[model samples]
Target: MKSLAITVWGMMALPGCRPGEDGEGIALVRSLPLSDQQKLCLEKMVDTFLPDTDTLGAVQLNIHRFLDKLIANCYPEEEQKSFINGLDILEGKAQDLFSKSFGSLENLQRESVLLGLDNEENAEEKAFFDFSKEQVILAYTSSEYFLTNFTNYEMIPGGYDGCVDVPEVPFKV
Candidate 1:
C-alpha cells in the first residue's frame, strides 16, 4: 500500500520535474550570484573547518558545492545576500591579515581567520559564521561517506537480537 501511494505521488510529481531546454541540470547555477573566486574561497573555508584526516573531509564529499547550492536555493534573498557579504567579510579579513585572498592563505592562517569570525565588531559576521558552522557540520554528518563508513547507516533500521521469544500461538492467516 505504501508503494502504491508512492507510485501515485511520483507519477503526480513527474510532470512538474522536467529538465531544462539543453539537457542541463540546475540551470540556476548560472544565475547564482557567487563569482568563481568566491566559490573557491568557500571551498577553502569548508575545508579549513573539516580538514581531511584518516577519513575524507567535507570538501572531498563536495560539501562546499552543496553549501553553495543550499544557500542559493533554500535561503531567502536577504539571507543569501548576507551570506555572500559574509564571504566578502572573510576575504577582507584575509587581505587585512595576510595581504592576500582567503583561498591563498596557509592552512594555519585559514584556521586563524575562521576562528576569529565571531568578533564583537560585526553582528553579521557572527551570525554568518554560526550558521556556516552549523551547515558544515550538518552536511558532513549527513554525507554518504560519513554515514556508510563511520556511523554504519541502516537503511530500514533493524538490528539483530540474540534472544527472542516466539509467539505462543501461531494462527493461520
Candidate 2:
C-alpha cells in the first residue's frame, strides 16, 4: 500500500519538482493553449487510453484537464506546441485510418489509433504521443477518486505512532 502511494507520487512528482510546491496538484490550472477541437479530441483520447473498468476512468477524473494544465505551467513552449500538435496528428491519423474524427471513434478503434501512434515513424510524433500518454496516466493514478476509493489513501493516513513500544517477538527460532 505504501509502495503504491509512493509510486503514484513518483509519477506526478518526477516530472516537475521545485521549491514551495507540493509536487501533487501542480496541474490545477488550464491555460487556453489548446483549440476546442483539440481539447474535445484529447478528452476522448484519454478516455480511450484508460476506459472505465472497475473504477472511474481518466475522463471521469478530468485527467485531460490535468495534462493540459501541467503542460501549460510546467512544460516549455515547444513541448506545449508538441502536445497540442500531437492532437492534430491523432486526428489526422484517425481520419486517414478510420475515416472518422478521433472523438467519434469506437473505443477499440480509438485505442488502436493511440497504440499505432506509439509506433509512428516520426520521432517527434512518437515523443509527443508518449509524453501525453504518460501525463494522462500520472494524472489518473494520482487523482482524488483513485487515491481515496481505489487505493484507500488518506490525506492524513490514520496510523499515527506517537509513542508506542513494540512487543517482543514470540516463538523466535
Candidate 3:
C-alpha cells in the first residue's frame, strides 16, 4: 500500500500533471470544487503548515496548488467531503478562538489555534487535519522543486562498487 501510494504520487508529480493548461501564475484551487472563501482558507492553512523560510515556502513552491490537484484528482469522494468539512471546522475553530477567519488571523494566533486543534480529542477533526497535513508534506517533499533544489536527490545514484572482495566467515553449522 505504501508503495502504491508512492507510485501514484510519483505519477502525479510528473511534468504537465497539472489539472489544467493555464499559463504560469494560475491558481490551482480554481479547478477544485471549493468556494473562493474555502480556497483562501485552505491556502492560508497550507501556508501556515509550510511557511516561508530564508529560501522557499509551500506557497512559493506551489504546494497548495499541488495539494488542490492531489485532493481533487486522487482522493475519493468521501475523503474529499471529509476534507472540505474539515476546512469548515478549522475555520470555525479559528473564529471561535480569535474572532476572525483563519486566513485573517495573526501568525501566532493561527499557530495557537492549530496547536489546540492538534491536541484536541475529536477523532474526525484530528483525522482530517492529519490527513491533510500528511498529503501536504508528501506533495511538497516529492515535488520537483524540492527534490532538485532543496535535496541531494539524484535521478541516478553513483555507480556500484562491484569489485570489492567478499569476506569469509566460519559457519557454526
Candidate 4:
C-alpha cells in the first residue's frame, strides 16, 4: 500500500498542490474567474464528455471543480484566458443553434453541439475542446473512485506462488 499512498500523494502534489484541497469539500470554483453561467456551462460540457455510466460520471467525480482548480491555479494566464474564451465560444455556438444556453440543453442537444464543434475546422474551438477533454480524462482517471473501484489497485502485488510439484522421474540412473 506504500506505492498506492505514494501515487495518491503524487497526484495531490501536482502543480497547484494545496493542503486540504480535496477537490470535494472546497468551493474553489467560485474563486475562479468564470461567472456562474460559465461555471454551469462547464459542468454541462463535462457531463457531455463523460456522462453517467455504471461508474461515476464527471459530475459525480467532481471533475468540473477539479478543472476549475487546475485552470485557476496550475495553468498560465494565457491558457486560462484561452479556456474561458473557448467556453464563451461554445456557449455562443449553443445559443446560435438552440436559442438556449448550453447548460439548459438536453443531453442529445449537448452531444450534437459538441459533435459540431469537434467537426468544425476552427482552430481555437478545436484547441479548447482538445485541452478540456485531455484535462477531464486526466482528472477522471486519477480520481479516487477510478483507483479504488475501476483499477482495484494495490500498492504491493500479491505474493508469488513459487512451489511446483515435481514429476517423478522414471528410470533415473
Candidate 5:
C-alpha cells in the first residue's frame, strides 16, 4: 500500500497538478460534500496559518483540495485513515485549550497551539504534526495570494544608473 501510494504521489507531483490553475483555487472544498466538522476544521486551519501578506493565503490556493488529493491518491491507507481520524484530535485539543474552538482561537492562541504541536516530544505525533504543518505552509505559499502579491516582474525595462548621488533639497516644497 505504501509503495502504491508513493507511486501515485510521484505521478501527481509531475507538474500537471500545479497548485494553482484555471479557477481551481482553494474553493474546491467548498463545492464538495465535506462534513460539517471537516469544513470547520479546514476553516480553522486556514485562518490560523494564513498571514496578511500580499501573496495568496492557503484558503485562496485551495490547499485543502490538494491535501485531499494527496491523502486519497498518495498517502498509505493507514496514514490517510489516521489523519482523517486524527483531525478531530487536533481540533478538539485546540478547542479545549483555547475555549473558542480551533476555528475561533485568536492569533496568539493559535500560534501557541501550533508551536506546541511542533515542539512535541512524542516521536509519532511530532512527525505527523510537522508533516501537516509543512503541507499547510506549502498550500498557503503556493496560493494565488503569494503568486500574485509576492512577486513583480515587468515586461518593459528602462536602464537606470547603478550608482548615483541625489542632491539634497533644502526646502520641503
Candidate 6:
C-alpha cells in the first residue's frame, strides 16, 4: 500500500522531471502547459475524485502527468493537441450547463455531461469527446498508481494450485 502511494506521487511529480523531446523510454514528451481556465478545469477534475485528503493521499497519483505521457506516446502530435483542446471545450460546456466544470461535477453529473456529449447529433464533437475520454483512461492506467498499486507484480512459482488437499485414488483396472 505504501509502495502504491509512492508510485502515485512519482507519477504526479513526473511532468516536471523529464525534459525535451529527445528524452527516452516514454519520458521525452513535454506536458502541455495548462491555461488558467484549464487549470480551473483540472482543479475541478481533481476535486471530482479527490474530496478527502485520505483518498487523495492514499492514491497520490498525478493523473495529469500520466495523461501527458499517454498523449505523447500514443497520439500523433497534431491529433494529441486537438484531443487535449477538446477537453478544454468539454470542460467549458460542463461549466456552462451545470455552473461547474466537468471535473468538479459529481460522478452522476459527469456521466450526464458525457451522455449529452455522446448524444449530440454533431458528429465532430462526439468524435472529439470520445477520443478525449479514451485518452483520459489511457493516461490513468499508465500512471504509476496503476502500474504499481493496482496490479500484482510479484513473481509466481511455476505451477498451478487448484486443490489444497486430495485423496489418493485406487488404480483403475
Report, for every candidate in turn, its global Cα lDDT versus the true structure.
Answer: 0.87, 0.84, 0.82, 0.88, 0.67, 0.64
CA error at residue 22 for candidate 3, angstroms: 20
TM-score of every prediction relative to native: 0.75, 0.71, 0.71, 0.72, 0.57, 0.52
- Candidate 4, residues 1-173, lDDT tens digits: the string is 99999999999856444445556444444446899999999999999999998878999989999999888888788999999998899899999999999999999999998888888899989888889889999999999888888797876779877998889889866
Candidate 5 has an lDDT of 0.67
User: How well is each residue in 1-173 modelled by candidate 1, as lDDT tens digits?
Assistant: 99999999999877656776876553544334888888889999999989998889988999998998888888889988998898999999999989999999999999899888965367888898899989999999988888888886977798889999987897799
RMSD of each: 5.8, 10.9, 9.4, 9.0, 14.5, 11.1
Model 2 TM-score? Answer: 0.71
Tens-digit lDDT string for candidate 3 (1-173): 99999999898766444445555554534446887878888888888888998868788888877787888877788988888898899899998987999989987887887777788899998887788789888978898888999799988889889799989998897
Q: By lDDT, is 3 or 5 better? A: 3
Candidate 3 backbone collisions, by pair: none
Model 2 lowest lDDT segment of ten: 19-28
Q: What does candidate 2's lDDT look like per residue over 62-153, in tens digits?
A: 88887877888888888788778889999999999999999899999998898898988989788977887788888887888878887868
For model 5 the local lDDT of residue 36 reads: 79
Q: How accurate locally is residue 80 in candidate 6, as Cα lDDT from 0 to 100?
A: 72
lDDT of 4 at 107: 95
- lDDT by residue (33-110, candidate 6, tens digit) is 566666556544433433335334212466655565556666688977776676677787787889986766776786
- lDDT for position 45 in model 3: 83
What shift in Å separates residue 40 of candidate 5 from its native position after superposition?
1.9
- At residue 13, what lDDT does model 4 achieve? 57
Clash count for candidate 6 is 3
Candidate 3 C-alpha error for residue 132, in Å: 1.5
Residue 51 shift from truth in candidate 2, angstroms: 0.9
- Per-candidate clashes, comma-separated: 0, 0, 0, 0, 5, 3
lDDT of 5 by residue, 65-141 (tens): 77777666666778776666556666766877877666677778877876776787866556767777777787666
